[model samples]
Target: MKEIIQINLDNEMDLILAHKRCMKIAEMCGMPSSFQTRFSTAVSEVARCAIAKGKNSLLVLGINIIKSTQKEIVAIITDSEDLKSCNPEAFNYAAKISGHIQYNYFDNQFTTTISQQVLSPGLLTETKIKGFIDYFKYEPPLSPYDEIRKKNIELIALSEKLTESENKYKQLANTIPILICVINERNNVLLVNESLENYLEKPLLTFERKTLTHFIHSADIDNVLEGLKRAKQNRSDYIGETRIKKGTNYIWHLVSITPNKAEDGTFNSWLVYFVDINAQKMIVETLKDNTELKMIQLELESANSQLRFKNKELQQFAYIASHDLQEPLRKIMIMLSRAGADLTEDQKKKFYFDRITLAAGRLSNLITDVLNYSRIENSEQYFEEVDLNKVIEEVLGDLSLIIEEKSAVIKVDQLPKVSGLDIQFRQLFYNLINNALKFNSGNPAVTIGYGDIPNDPNFTGSAEKYDVISVEDNGIGMDSSYSGRIFDMFQRLHERDQYGGNGIGLALCRRIIENHNGLINFSSKPGVGTTFWIYLPKNKRS
Candidate 1:
């Protein structure tokens, strides 16, 4: 449902009544006070033009729906003749206030449509507003100039009211907290409030002749000027952030410029507002410094964690070396002591000498494993782009004799180039392949393949994706219970009579993978195959 109000604009009083009626309906429609003034003023201007051209006019007020959930007041002024009078200033001021104005001359009728959104706090009480609405509907129309004498008197009163408004505006400007100033098109200060003086720590008169950019930081002068240029060219407001000079010190502020028009409704000057944002800027700086400090703390914690891990590893190595290294030597000594001159040649050859040789070989292997395990940490420091396929091919070549003797099948897929130590990679592949061949049931066969880490069951982390390289062998695998235990130093599941190993090869692989920030995990079942999955980060040093 919509409401309509009509008023004849034949006299000054009649026109004024039309304006008041339009405003009441616009207010009933919940229009803001500012827009009510604009809409009614635009209605008066259009109705006045029709009367000035010696024509009859009627003003129509109705509630209009602009879009879904949006309603506005629509003011229509229709004239009996196509009036020649047009006031651009009135149209512009109306446009500035309501943001809408339409005029058309057709069918020997000149019509103007002025509209404004009716957004306010409350709905009109129909009973309370009915008297005002009836004023436009029931009043008898008057001559267009019947109240000319009274209009002359009101004009004189309006001149005095204008002077009082200027004083009130100045008083309002002085009371605001932010720095407010008005600058002319020439960029010279036309007026500034008392807040401006407090910001500069000087009297307002001192800034009168200087250009507005004089107080801005040199580095920020261009930005302020650019904002000014854009606001002027576009005839709108613009906001900018910059530092302003407060004597020898600089403080940041949000500078906003709004075009201020003169009485003739042309863009006369810019009303500038400087809102001090120094406290916000200081808070940001403090947060940045705190973030940097937090990052350093995180790095220190990571380094300490690595150091703790290495210390625990060293403790385990000491235990293994102290206990295991002396076993072979003690056995050798015992064999020699028991055979002192009482040993026959056959006994010496079969028992004492052979036992001594076997003990020596075990001792040698133990020492070599210990050295290799320790060297994994210290041997590599710098990294280069390494082709793993080439390294795997080279490892196969090194073990050619063993491969041929065992009649093993070696299948390798194309591998990727990774950022790592090539020597360590070769050692890693060589140890895995050699172990697979040695532990096979009869003939050895190993397959090496690579893929993304997300497909591997061992990866359980966020999407910081990694690459997976798997080495699988169809050899005699151990029980699942020993899957994690096989990587420990000297942790052999099989006796020396069955399998010959110091049990440090897998341990070395674990250290190398740890140094590269990777994971080494294996899945196995007794008498089935075992696959070792190595997960490495795609593009990181640690």
Candidate 2:
């Protein structure tokens, strides 16, 4: 007659679930074999009657007794529906019957009560008691109720195994390196692991009163809000990334979320885990910055190149003007000479007419040399495939008169074919030959020769494509002191009158060779002859 169970349920499903809960609870508590089924069934039947007939309320408050001697255990439930809805006479009758049953059992008594107010929307009142039927110890009662109770004991043992499995799962979660947390529908954290406190740098209790927003960075608030809304609304997993602001720095994290639902399939809270990914974020940002820097550098280089080109164009324009002006000056010098020559003996203007004519001729030659130098200086012309030997022969033909006049003993050798501008190459050879013929000490004995030094170790260039072209002479050799400036513009070691020409010839030769991307250099001794060497790169057809 002890108070075992009571319920006041509005829905039949709730009553059923409650009944199952009671049976499971009985199984979990290790109820004795003699009373296991009787206890669970008695509680189920009482709860069913209360919920169906009484107002809607069900409450199983607490367990009060466990008695091995009588094989009896008791729980108390407070229900108020019976007092208001049941007939007073029938209730009194049932109470009397239960009292008689308790007295026949033992000296102890148990009672579970039902009041009218318990059915109302308030707290349920509960009472529990235990009675033992231990007097007939020699032969225990063996009823169908006792057999059902034994099965309940077995079921309880199995449930203990399930609880052990649950503990194992919790242990597994604890072993993970990541932080884990469970939150409720109200956004309140329900459970947090030790790993969560590791990163938080605070105690677990500190997060108890705070919502998820309290730990998140302000800039990421909007994104977090959206993800939270989606998780709760759809009751599905949502994932995203955000940075957690440390003091002055920030730690980036990748968050994964999983949603759980309530018994009624309503929205629940998310199961969240945050993973640190700050290193990867920093690498991506660094690469982006470097790329931007390279682009800026390239743009600056392009601008510098454009400026240099413009400057070159201006210089070329000045050179062209100077070159064109020389023709008129040459003409004026010739006219001045002619007018001087026409002066009469009495005029006194012809006192030095020979000297004047010579001076005018020199001036005219200077103008012609200046114009040629300017034209070559401003030119950006390129070279093509041409035979150097042919260019040399043509230059010799042009200087045939000078060769005959000097009675020069000129000796020539075979030359190689090279990629070069025909006119420039001819000028280059012509200048060198002129210098040799002009500077002869005795009767001209100039020898122009061409030969390659097989794999010349002294030559430092791409061996596969570079070759040296030597123009050697056996004329009056120059002093070592003047050899260095031999290719300088208007730089004459000997006087202009002595050399019978301006000193721009060798300088123009240097320019023409350099324009072909070749080197022009010479070696000389005071008494020995000189040799001018041109090292050029071979052009590939491709």
Find the candidate with the highest TM-score and give its number.
Answer: 2
Candidate 2 C-alpha lDDT tens digits along 1-542: 33443333555554565555455445434554333444445444555555556554455423432222232234443454443234444444434433311112122322343211111111121211221122211223244544454466569889999999988988887778777888765466777777776667665343113456657787675577678878777777878987764445668888887886668976556688878888997787677877797997898678657857986897787667766766676776677667766677665354665666577677767776776766664335555688887888888899889899988877777777887678778878888888888787766777666655442333445545655677666777888677667888878787766778777888888777656656666777666677787777677311
Using all chains and alpha carbons, the TM-scores for the candidates as numbered come to 0.38, 0.39
lDDT of 1 by residue, 38-94 (tens): 778877777777666636787777666555466667788888765434566655666
Worst 10 residues of 2 by lDDT: 115-124
Q: What is the C-alpha RMSD of each candidate to the true structure, in Å?
A: 27.7, 39.2
Model 1 earns a TM-score of: 0.38
Whole-model lDDT values for every prediction: 0.76, 0.62
Candidate 2 colliding pairs: 2-110, 8-57, 8-58, 37-149, 78-125, 80-115
Cα deviation of 225, candidate 2, in Å: 58
Question: Model 1 RMSD to the real structure?
Answer: 27.7
